[model samples]
Target: MTHLPLAGRRVIELGTMVAAPFATHILSQLGAEVIKVEPPTGDTTRALVRGGPSGTFIAYNHGKKSLSIALDTPEGRDVFRRLVASADIVIHNLSPSATRKLQITADDLAAVNPRLIYCHIRGYAAGPQHDDLATNPVAEASTGVMDDHRIDGRPSRLGPSYHDQFAGAYGVIRILATLLQPAPTAEERRIEIGLYETGLHVAARDLAGVQLKMQLLGRPEKEGGGEFSMPGYGAYQVNDGRWLYLLVLTDAHWQKLATALGMPEADDPALAKLRERKKQRERVEAAVRAAVGKLGFDEAAERLRAAGVGFSEVLPLERVLAAPQARQPGKLRDLDYRGLHFEAPEFPGQAECSPGLPPPELGEHTVELLRGLGFDERACAALVEQRAVAVAREGDFAWAPVRPEASGKA
Candidate 1:
């Protein structure tokens, strides 16, 4: 078998919720040895749901070792420093104050491992609000993401924690770039990714568009947001009560869609051009709605496919797993946590490798890892007894699988 790109890399992850953990998760998927450092109480995400192993935790923390330690204690700090000495990378999303209090900042750990690639995920960049606590929603709101995606005239956060995930992705990008640096440097390899900054980056095109319009027209652009400026470029319900999102971008696509749906009203030459179609959006959309309303989803999909007009049935979350596209080989990996079978998407472009271990139980590898760090069994026990470290006991790990009936018919 071929080695994964990150086969020999070692990552020490000190993060909760999403950002930092997600960065390490990607590294783990690429075959990095990720040691997740959690507090003795465990990561808060462990209990995000009512039961053990919250979905949030499982989604982002699979395939890593867990080391539960009380960083507040001197012994725990010593152990962490020891781990950092041999680690290739260290990533954390702890608040600025907490980072200082714990003394795991880039400078602190750089003294132990000069070649370390350290990534710090923060709510904001270094500024007045740098120390402020921020979550995904807070960052989205601070930037214009929430406002840009407003619904019914009220700001609404996106369904997924995209800002947090993007921040994590950014962390991964910087870490990998540092690792690929041709020459070893004396200066610390420090990377900082702020959720707020990531949000702004995500909204860059929209921000630029608005500014450009203001400059050209000398007035603020009118708010007309809902993802579609052109006709036949939105969701429509069919006779079978299923939604299909249609994309009629080019004039050829518009013509194809009209012809496929047999919409006589769209045959007018005036509606052939995109600008003309936009001017008569209501009529074009009405024709589309009426035509689609007359056909079942399957028939509409067939006709659209035959015409080569882009369209897809809007499957809900539950149906997404069973989607044909998702079932393709290498798209997802079967994973089990405490015997509860589930599937998760594989990292894009990852080489096929031996299946990774499931998300580790809290301190699941503490004894083994400590022993590798030159601590004997008795010393490991002493540290545990001192409340400086924790180990997962038998039966401490459990998982509640989704009931078959809950999935409905795929």
Candidate 2:
């Protein structure tokens, strides 16, 4: 709270789901004052995930204020305009067409706040394929990452919402950099991110392969083994069904790893040269990773590191959450909204990591924000009754209705 860099900054998040919400959520974690503007029904993400709505919704939205307003209404539009007029940044991830349809464009907001940094997370950049349909799978499929990571030429889903999260992180980096620069003389500065394009960039190997096929004439054929960045790198299974990763890439490390496995140097003539050993990459990797099946997880990790191989246990998501680093005061936080338990990564250490307010319940700060803008209690209440804005619960770490309109129902 006290040490956050973005303490005095103000942000208005007019976005839904992972990418845009997460980008702004990171800002809130940095102590920035973020107001999440939702439509009357709330962000659709609130109903996502298996057990019910709100799996990742809370995961990436734990420290911002929510303002549920009917953006389709004229009064709602005015409220949004007022919110943007007072913000340092505005974030949104609606489709290009949807953005125009909503009339919440950069031009619209920046007209009020000249120094506004408007960040738009689009599913695609302008081009021949830009207007094509978009979704996580389509983004990955279009970017050819699915093809690159595929085995037997069969496509597969990339881990997690890779495109969505990558786009979220990309938006964060853009905002931070824009903030560092001289504030624009004009009202708005536009920063657009395309999930389809950015996802391909994040799939570094796929980007490398484009050049590999074009620039490098002597490109080696793709093999049965994995990517060739290093020999002793990536997942290996242990006898007890545990897994670990080893990343030993130098001559000394190779020797150390081989010795740790008691895999003698004179096993075969190919062992004489690292190049020759790499030519038999599949067999070599099989020998190394397969050793885990005999050595057990702990024994293999210990022996491997002792032999100079960089090895680490691969814990499941739950186990990883309980890891020492995750429990550290400055790394993560367990946020309890009503009875719902959620976790969020703290701000980056180099940025602002001291814990800030939890995500605000819908319109939690409506009165306060309205008062700041010259509204009296009566005016604020009038606006709330009109469904233009609503108050969040009191003393909430983040906004609190859990369901912003739930209490109103009862």
Candidate 3:
């Protein structure tokens, strides 16, 4: 395996669940030393996924060490500061006020390490709607992303935890950029990446369609696709008990599709010539659906490809994981960390190695980390005896109760 791109980097994560932990996950996968600082219990994501093996937590916190410290104590906060002082970057997805409450504020961390890159993942950007104590669903609805999930144009919520993922990807980009600077651009840069902003950034290009309609119709639209977006961009059902995507956009592709459908000028030219077809997308959608139902997915795909059209069969996760792509040794690796195994994605020309340590079995590294921090054997033992920290054992229970309000849904 080749060396990871960000090897030798250090990151201190003060977030939980998703968002910032996800950013650190990618960093850790790329060979950065990520230390996840959690409260004595551990992160909430350990049980987030249904019937999954701490998969949600493992997916984000892989290849990182855990520091189970109850920062509720001044001693804990001071210990955290010392750790943050030694880190090259510090990140969290806690609310702004919660960040200040945790005492890992930008000034606090920078005071300990001036060059620290501080990044915070938020729900709303700023101002009146900023940080509404949101969970994944609340953040999705607040950002108008939930509305897109519904076909009827009604405002609904997202089906998954995308808001958190959004903030996670958002933070990862800024952290990578900050690390690549010739030198530190500023002493302490507080990058605020809101969940809403991430959604907006994603939809900006699509919003142009609505904006263009407003210009042509002399009235602004409240959403994308004001009766016409494009006929080739949606899902259609197939004949052989499956669904497929038919994308025939360009003139030539449309012509090919027309021939495949056995309809004269069914191409975009025919589409362009029809005053009704130009505005009636539902009619176009129905026609395309009817055309697809006449042939099996494979037959339709072949016909479309022959005509320079694009198509793909809807595949389940199990099918995807068993495909030739997944079988490629360079594409993925089934790794075992402390008895938990999962397939992790591998990058092209980049190596992903298991850590010197396992997933840390909750607080398995607590005493060892304390010892490395210059704590003597007796002191380390004392902290454990006092329940200030914990060590994972086969029969031991590490499940800790989380304060309900502190539950980070997003």
236-286: candidate 3 lDDT, tens digit per residue: 778778988666555555556668776643744547533445476676777
| Candidate 2 TM-score versus the reference | 0.85
Lowest-sum lDDT 10-residue window in model 3: 347-356
Candidate achieving the largest lDDT: 1
Question: In model 1, which regions exceed 4 Å deviation?
Answer: 184-188, 351-353, 395-410
Which runs of model 3 end up more than 4 angstroms from their true locations? 49-53, 129-131, 151-154, 185-188, 222-228, 264-269, 272-276, 280-283, 337-340, 347-358, 395-410
**RMSD to native for every prediction?**
2.8, 5.4, 5.3
lDDT of 2 by residue, 313-367 (tens): 8887778877776777666776776666667676657323544455556566667
Clashing pairs in 1: none
Please name the candidate that would achieve the greatest TM-score relative to the true structure.
Answer: 1
Q: How do the predictions measure up, each by TM-score? A: 0.94, 0.85, 0.85
lDDT of each: 0.85, 0.72, 0.70
